[model samples]
Target: MKKLLAALVCSLPLVSALAVDVYDRDPDHTFAFFEFNHLGFSTQRERFDKVDATVTLDLENQVGSVEVSIDVRSISTGSSMFNQILLSDTFFDVEKFPVVTFKSTKLNFGKLDDVVSVEGELTIKGITHPLTLTVTQFKCAMHPMLRKSACGLNATGKLRRSEFNLGRFAPLISDQITLLVSMEALKR
Candidate 1:
């Protein structure tokens, strides 16, 4: 009985260590950017200014769940002309579809701490498709200034613009869009 009691006592710390932590995205640090081949020339890069996400990380199970939303109207390109173009019916059609969202279904760890494959549904322009974002660098640590537990992730993926019904200049322009993302979240 004493031996069993001691084992139970020691397991308390393990349980505490595996406690899941939920976090809210830090808008100031989270950005979803993308690059696409333009006219067989230089790659054009753009990003959404407004992004929100919630992350629930289960350290014990080595899994996580995340929901990310992006405001289509907040899309930014280097040039105002291009930005407006993207918001028009030819592209994002922000007037009709104002937002894009991703809800994670599963997280596959390459290594518990190094990389993870996040499989999810990406909805845009009224279309939902399966997508995967490979998170390459992930860390959870205490912030130096805020002193709060914070986590950051670097992930990338690619999608075919045609799949989302944004294929305006298809044959001429590239259909593949590269997604670049950086996210910082604070424990909530």
Candidate 2:
């Protein structure tokens, strides 16, 4: 009985450690920003006000997955006129499609570095396309303010707006849009 009790006590820590949840979506710390060429001369920037995501991290396998959705109507370009025009049919057409989403299918963990490459299907304006995001600096630690375990990652990718059927602006608004994603997940 004594030996059995000792073994059980030793296994408890292991079990608890294995049960630790990883990859939480911290709504306050996550943001998605995009930049695109305007008039063939200048770059225009915009950001979404509302972003939501779900993340799953497998520590034993060193793998992670994420799914994120952004409200199209929440786009902010720092100008009310431009913002309204963007929400119109010429751009995002928020009236018809309210949300844009990305669902990651695979995550390739780096052997020597903290970076991970992610491949996923991005859905926009009712069209889906496969995209690869090179994620750099993925980390997990305790948050001082939230008092919870947090995970952060940065990713960059480019997508052609025309491919998603958002070609109204065409030459006027550049087809290639650069995307930057900064996300923080908190353990639930």
Candidate 3:
């Protein structure tokens, strides 16, 4: 009995080392942005101010999951008129669906333990669609100031606004929208 107890105690560190790590999104550094072409003139970019997410990573298994929630009413378009229009039923319908969400279905990793792409379902205005976000930049290390393990990633994906029933201004405002996500998460 003492031998078994000793063995279990010795294996505790190994078991904990193989466990997954959870991280909480740092609101100050995480943001979700979208850009669309405007009447073939230029691109208009806007961001959601309120976003929250939780990430779990198992480096040993090269598996991870990300779940993000964005407040639709927190749209920032620089102009109050634009923000109001986006929040209305024509676009986001904040009254009916105040939150947008993305839940990961799979996470592809590279040889260096970096995420290559994230296959997930993106929900907007209550409509859910499968979207794959390509990770362009990613880094996981000890934060200089925070003094904790952290990860920062930049990912982008394209989606059609029409698919989500937000196609009020199709060709003129562009139905294709580029979704950009920059997030920093600290170990929990």
Candidate 4:
């Protein structure tokens, strides 16, 4: 533990220096959607309409970080009945766990350009678990309409819903969940 502590202590300066670009999430452009198999017939998709997030990056260092907050009540499935079922105690239990969150712990860079993995802890249904988001597309420039420097990216990841206690139907409904996150942020 001492060596681990020493390593972390030594990395502080690098971390502090790498916080070059700070951004506020663009709600209109950001989306966090998920997919999972429903029974054996087909796949179901849902998304949370309300999400708040902040992202930062150090391009030269190939490092980045993200923090996100998702309003559980905002989860939508197009059908009101399905939405209500998802919010019930057997699923997300939105009344007891009103929010879902993710905060980065580390950044892993790929050898190829525009590819990096964000390691983070995700909390859902009041349970926290580790997750990684692989950035597939990344771009930054001035937004013509808003005239604000902005960055946008799409990331993908997978998780086991059972880990978060959202395994209502279990094997039948499929425990694995896939995530597709598209986020755009403006410089703060």
Candidate 5:
């Protein structure tokens, strides 16, 4: 009985340490930016200010999961009028659809160092599409400033705006939009 009790106590820490909680979205360290071609002349850039997410990370297995949501009305393009036009009926229609979301289903750790591929569902304008994100870097460690475990990930993906019914400025603005996502999550 004494030996069994000792063994159980020794293994308890390992079990607790292996489990990871999904973290809250850290706005300070998170960024969602997108770029599109402007009449084949220059690349137009924009960013969303409000973002929320829940992330689960498994460092040992090299697999991580995330669900991110963004407010369409918060999009900023450096021009108030243009931003308002984007939120109007022809574009995002923020009044009818308030949120755009992405939910991950599978995470594949690639052979390359710290490289991962995530496949998920992206919902925008009431349309759901399967999207894959190629993750370049992923890291988790104790934050020196916050004194809590934190994780960071960077990913890039491209989606056609027309697929989600965002086909307002078709030829004027390129159909393909490049999305860049960078997020840092703190353990809850």
Candidate 6:
């Protein structure tokens, strides 16, 4: 009995160390951008102004998940008239669906125990569809200014706006949208 107790006590630190670490998204540093072709004249990009997320990482077990919420009403297009148009029934329909969300179903990890891609479900306009985000860059380190553990990543994904009921002009304004997520999370 004494030996069993001793062994269990000795492994406490190891168990705790392997536990998942939860991080809250730093809203000030996280944003979601969308890019699409505009009449084939040029590429147009816009971003959501409000994003919130919670991320969990288990480096020892090579598992993690992310849940992100974006305010659809906060779309910024650099033009007030265009922004309002996008908020109308043809685009985001912000009055009906005020938020878009992504919840991870799987986290694909690289050899370095880092997340390489995330398989998730994206919800928009009350419809959900499968989406995968490829992590282009990922880094986890002590934040120089915050003096806290932090993780940051740039991820890209693509989806057809028509699938989410956000397609208005189709090929003319572009139905395909490229998703770019620049996110930073702080350990909690």
Error of 1 at 58 (Å): 0.7
lDDT of 2 by residue, 95-168 (tens): 89999999999877877535487899999989999999888668877888889888789999999989988877
Which wins on TM-score, candidate 2 or candidate 4? 4
Tell me the whole-model lDDT of each prediction, alpha carbons only.
0.89, 0.84, 0.94, 0.88, 0.86, 0.94
Model 5 spans with C-alpha error above 4 angstroms:
1-18, 111-115
Tens digit per residue, CA lDDT, model 1, 142-186? 988889999999999999999999988886788999998899999
**lDDT value, residue 50 of candidate 2:** 82
For residues 73-174, what per-residue lDDT tens digits would candidate 4 score against the true structure? Answer: 998899999999999998989888999999999878666536467889999987899999998887788999999999888989999998999877789988
Which ten residues in a row are the worst by lDDT in model 2? 16-25
lDDT of 5 by residue, 1-188 (tens): 99999999999878866775678878987878889999999998899988898888665556667899999888989999999999998889899999999999888876543548789999998999999988878777898899998878899999999999997778799999998898888998
Please say which candidate is ahead in lDDT: 3 or 4.
3
Cα RMSD for candidates in order: 3.4, 4.0, 2.5, 6.6, 3.2, 2.2
Give per-model TM-scores. 0.89, 0.85, 0.92, 0.85, 0.87, 0.93
TM-score computed on alpha carbons, candidate 4: 0.85
lDDT by residue (tens digit), candidate 3, 1-188: 99999999999888966688899999999999999999999999999999999999987788899999999888999999999999988788899999999999999999899998999999998899999999999888999998999998999999999999999878899999999999999999
What is candidate 2's local distance difference test score? 0.84
Q: How many backbone clashes does candidate 3 have?
A: 0
Write the candidate numbers in order of decreasing TM-score.
6, 3, 1, 5, 4, 2
Extract clashing residue pairs from model 3: none
Cα lDDT of candidate 6 equals: 0.94
Query: Best candidate, TM-score-wise?
Result: 6
